[model samples]
Target: MGDFVLSGNVTRRENKLIPHWKGPHRVVVTNNGWTYDVQEFVAPFAIITRHIMRLKIFRDKYLGVTEDLWEYATYANGGHMVQRFLDCKMKFDTHQWEVLVQWRGLDEAENSWEPARILLEDFPLLLARWVRTDAKAEGMRSFVLNETSSRRGK
Candidate 1:
């Protein structure tokens, strides 16, 4: 057996801040017992996004969350925020990253619906599909469509 490892990062898309956690994370991330990882993920955005604040035109425009809020990664130039926590020596199996992407999109849509129902209804699925396709381009195999449930088995 291998020791569990934790890695995390915070991401900003439009006005929302999403925290990402990965363990040698082969499955869903638990919501507790990973404060350090969560803190690391959120600290950067909390520090720099201060200056980017602006008043939101509509209370529920971009989802229920305030559009005026900014995140730490927003200060940087390109690429999404990524903090790799556990690169275990044991070779983890290659799995499709798209399913993860779709799952996240669905989760976000649910969270955002109350604040921004229009976006949840309009573009999230399209965005999720695009992200899934992008993950494929980055060398992840499609787990749901082609292979075994355990990515390691492949």
Candidate 2:
């Protein structure tokens, strides 16, 4: 029941510059009418947002062209595009690395913990950039970077 579609229902202040659509919500249900239940993807993989919108509403969205700074577009092969790697921490129970993934169009507080293994496999370049910036930004030890480099060699 998961498919992406924009929703034109989020409220906003009256402004001539505002975009009409609010989401690339995942479809959750097919109600009896012309409406559908959609949800925004939130962090922790547990929270839910409910917004049911009709198929049209002055047809909200961009001009069908993706901009570089815009958020949450999938890769050509269909997966979330990694906007940035914001932070990292070792999971105490799993004993593995989890990188904080900054999804486009979302706040830092909404970023989710993504497995380093998946990021390494999927978006190595973004992971590398984060490694360099994070180490410099916070004076983190290079042990993690070194570990990453070793993984990259394979």
* The best candidate in terms of lDDT: 2
Model 1 lDDT tens row, 1-154: 1112234456999999765533221112333432221212223422111110211111212222211112212211222221111111112463213222222323443322111122222233322233355543233223222322342245
Tens-digit per-residue lDDT, 37-128, candidate 2: 66554332222444444333322232232321122322322555555666777788988778778775677787898887776666544455
What are the Cα lDDT values of the candidates? Answer: 0.26, 0.54
Misplaced by over 4 Å in model 1 are 1-6, 25-154
TM-score of 2: 0.42
lDDT of 2 at 113: 87
Off by more than 4 A, model 2 = 1-77, 106-110, 136-148
Worst 10 residues of 1 by lDDT: 47-56
lDDT of 1 at 97: 33
